[model samples]
Target: MTSTADSYFVCATPRTGSSLLLGLLESTGVAGRPQAYFREPGEPMWAGRWGLPSTAGYDEYVRAALAAGRTDNGVFGAKLMWGTLDLVVDRLGAVHPGLAGHDVELLERAFGRTRFVYLWRDDVLAQAVSWLRAEQTRLWEADGEAEPGGHAPGYDAAGIEELVERIGEHNAAWERWFASCGVQPHRVRYEDLDADQTGVTRGILAFLGLDLPEGRKIAPSHRRQSDELNAAWIERYSRESARS
Candidate 1:
């Protein structure tokens, strides 16, 4: 029931610029978008979401990914959001009862020599605020309405507190898991990656163990699509976390 990822995996908290990071990795020819369309006949990996490809239909995809790892062509990576991680955790947990308790470790053991980039911002309240904004966007998108261009509304004390606690728990969970594995995961702060493109990108390239191609400009605006509406997301989350 549990299926180990045969290639590299990118496991990180959502809204941490994983998409932008994926774009950068793909640009370097090392990462590929997931074919989440189908898992097997009549079963979709992503269900009806985004028209991603099914696993069974992705035979060449797996081969290409494995080849990319063995050869020096590029770093083969897949972006694993919390949703994907949860799915894998669910499936794997069925196979190994306690796998949920050690999701990161099980993943590392499954994919030997695999690398992970765990991106996080230091401001806890800000992350909460961002999460709120993302939720609003999702609701709007699902309703087939236009995305909100500004903050929806201020958070109540209970809302803010709940958000901070939840995010903090998620952060703490991954931090401890990474430590237990004895794998020094590469970290990228959102602010630093935004402020210093060249340095952050160089660090990322180094973590991926790939040489930076000469004169390739790492663009500054290449992060996940967060708009002005989400500005309060990080701020609120950081503030709430600090208070607690």
Candidate 2:
């Protein structure tokens, strides 16, 4: 059996119920979400906090915690959404192209001690459309009212397509990087989690080496559709379903 000293890394794409997973972990006191990066308790932003490291970087942060010598419990875990794979990989490549090669040596050297949790959504096309609508909603809400430029500003047909491609490329690169690292990550399907809570939660617990509290329910929100008659705007944007 892997010792309790083993740590964990939850690596996943955005919109994969990572927040709910993290929330469940938090309740156990065995794992914690990074306060500085995760920001407020429940607000979910894809990369705003999760991708931004402290001055020392992500691996350094985990290393520091380990160095603190506080292991009364078992492993410590943190999440990094896979949507950030491209952004981080590209940046690493610019500094040292070799780092992007087999094993992502730079990253592994920093975080290989962690057991990885890889989360993916099956309906990737729908995920992209959902992201577009969310972004548009944010812009509209930020304006404190409706602007004259339709549902979303500057996000036309071409823009949506680009976003979809970007997300797809990021997902591909994420799988590739982990494979090259020789890391057999624990894979979690978003649809499965939604459909079978008992099974998905058990899988996650088994991977993390943790037990669940009795009567705890695992409910993850993957669908963003609103059912009210007054939610026409949200419906229109989400149901557009025009891939890019």
Top candidate (TM-score): 1
TM-score of each: 0.63, 0.60
Every candidate's lDDT: 0.54, 0.53
**Candidate 1 residue-wise lDDT, 125-211, digit = tens:** 666665665664453222234444644555555665676788777778777766877767678886776666567766766666666
Per-residue CA lDDT of model 2 for 76-137, tens digit only, reads 55666654444444544555566665334544444444577777887765555555654655
Worst 10 residues of 2 by lDDT: 34-43
lDDT of 2 at 79: 64
